[model samples]
Target: MAHYRASESKREQFRRYLEKAGVMDGLTNVLVALYEATEKPNDALDFIKQHLGPGADSTDAEGSRVELSELQHKYDLLLEENKELKNRLLQYEPAADHRGVE
Candidate 1:
C-alpha cells in the first residue's frame, strides 16, 4: 500500500511537470499526426525515427559530404543576398541624406 502511494505520487508529479512544460500538447500533436499518417502498425517506429533522429548527420562519409555540400551552397547564397542588400542600402542612403540637408 505504501509503495503504491509513492508510485502514484511520482506519476502525478511527472504528469504535472509535462503539463507545466507544454510538452503534453506538443507530444500529443506529433503522435496524433504520425498516427493519422501511418498505414501499418510498424510504421509508428519508423516515422518517429524519421522525424526525431539526427536526420542527415550520419557517420557515413557520403551522408557527411552531402550535408557539408548543402550547407556550403546555402552559405554562398546568403552571402550573395547580403552583398545585394548592402548595395541597395548604399544607393538609398545618399538620396535620404540629400533630402535631410534641404
Candidate 2:
C-alpha cells in the first residue's frame, strides 16, 4: 500500500509539473489523472466522463491529442532544421583557405 501511495504521489507530481509547464489544460489534466488511476485508456475515458463535468466530450479530447501531436511534429521539424543549419555552417570554407595563409 505504501508503494502504491508513493507511485500515486509521483504521478501527481508529474501531473502538476505538466500543468505548470503549460503542456496541458484542465480537461487534459483530468484525462491524465484518469489515465494514472486506471492504466487503461478506456477507464481513463470513463474517469474523464465522471470527473471532468461537461468538458469530457470527444471534440475536446481530440483537440488536446491533436495539439500534442502538432507540438511533436513541430519539435521534430525544428530539430531537423537545426541539424541542417549546423551541417551547412560546418561546410563553410575558412578565410585562411582563400588566402593560403598556412
Candidate 3:
C-alpha cells in the first residue's frame, strides 16, 4: 500500500541518519560492552548512563558522587558551626528594648 511504503521510506531515512551520525555504532558498542561484562551491573540504566553519558567513566561518576557526599557533610558541619558562632555573638549584643533614638 502507499501508506506502508511511505512509512517504510521514513523509517529507512531515519536509520540512515542514525548511521551517518554514528549513533548506531556508538549504541552498538555500548550494548556489546554491556553484553560482554562478566558480572551484570545491579542498575543497568545507571551502567548505561556511566558508559554513554558525558565523561563516560563509571569510576569518575562514582568518585564524583563520593566527593559530593563528603562536601555535603562538610557543608552541614559548617552550617552548624556558623549557627553556633552567631548564637555566641548574640550573647554580647544589647537587647532590642535598650535602644533609644538620639
Candidate 4:
C-alpha cells in the first residue's frame, strides 16, 4: 500500500508540473483544433509539429495554410496584371533616341 501511494504521489506531482508550465493548456487547445478540423491531416504527427513546433505560437495551422494559398494566388494574378499594364504603357511611350550624333 505504501508503494502504491508513493507512485500515485509522483504522478500527481508530474501533472501539477505540466499544468504549471502551460503544457496542459497548449496540448489541450491543439487537440481540440485537431478534433474540429474538417479535413483530417494525413500525418497526425506532422500536424502536431506544425502547430507546436519551433516558432509556432498559433494553433490555427490549417487556417494559416489556406490563407497563405489564397494570398499567393492573388499575388500571382496581380503580378500578371501589372506586367500586362506595363506592356500596354510601353506601346504609347515615345521611343528613346539611341543616336548620340546631333
Candidate 5:
C-alpha cells in the first residue's frame, strides 16, 4: 500500500511538472490527432514532422493510405492466384513416354 501511494504521488508530481512547462496541452492535442488518424503512423518522429513541418501534405493523408492498403491487398490476392494457376498448368503437361521419347 505504501509503494502504491508513492507511485501515485510521483505520477501527480510528474503531471504537475508537465502542466507547469506549458507543453502538456500541446502534447495532448498532438496525441489526440494521432489517435484520430486512420492509418496510424509507425514512426512518431516522422508523424510529428508531417504535421508540423513545411512539407506537410495539403491533400487527404488518410484517404491516400486507405487507397494504398486496398491496392496492396488486391496485389497479394492476385499473386497467390497466379501461383496456384501456375502449379495447375504444370500438372497438365503430358508426361513423355520413356519407351521412345527418351
Candidate 6:
C-alpha cells in the first residue's frame, strides 16, 4: 500500500508538471502569433489555424475581443487629447494671425 501510494503521488506530480508545461507552450504560441500578426495578419491567422487546432478561431476571437476593448479605451483617451491640442492650436492661431496686421 505504501509503495503504491508513493508511485501514485509521483504520477500526479508528473501530470501536474506536464499540464503546466502545456499551458506555458500555449501562451508562448499565442505571443508568437501576436508578433506575427503585427507584421502579417493573414499569415498569422493561417499559422494559427494550422498549428492551434480547430478551436483556434474561437481562442483567437476571444483574444481579439480583449485587445479591441483595450485599444478602444486608449483611442478614446487619445481623441480627447487630440481635441485639447486642436483647441490649443486654435488659441495660438488667432494671436499669430493678428500679429502681421498689428
Model 2 clash number: 0
Model 3 spans > 4 angstroms off: 1-5, 20-23, 34-57
In candidate 1 the C-alpha lDDT for residue 75 amounts to 100
Candidate 2, 11-98: lDDT as tens digits: 9999899889765787677766765764566455566667656664778889999999999999999999999998888678555446
RMSD of each predicted structure: 11.3, 12.8, 4.9, 8.8, 12.1, 12.3
Cα lDDT listed for each candidate: 0.78, 0.78, 0.92, 0.89, 0.82, 0.79
C-alpha TM-score for every candidate = 0.42, 0.38, 0.56, 0.55, 0.38, 0.38
Candidate 1 clashing pairs? none
Best-fitting candidate, measured by lDDT?
Answer: 3
Total backbone collisions for each predicted model: 0, 0, 0, 0, 0, 0
Best by TM-score: 3
Tell how far residue 37 is off in model 4, in angstroms.
0.4
Against the true structure, candidate 6 reaches a TM-score of 0.38
Cα lDDT, model 5, residue 34: 92
TM-score of 5: 0.38
lDDT, ranked from best to worst: 3, 4, 5, 6, 1, 2
> Which lDDT tens digits does candidate 6 get at residues 1-102?
999999999999987897777965875777686776656665665676666676667878899899999999999999999999999998768766466653
Better of 2 and 4 by TM-score: 4
- List the pairs of residues colliding in candidate 2: none
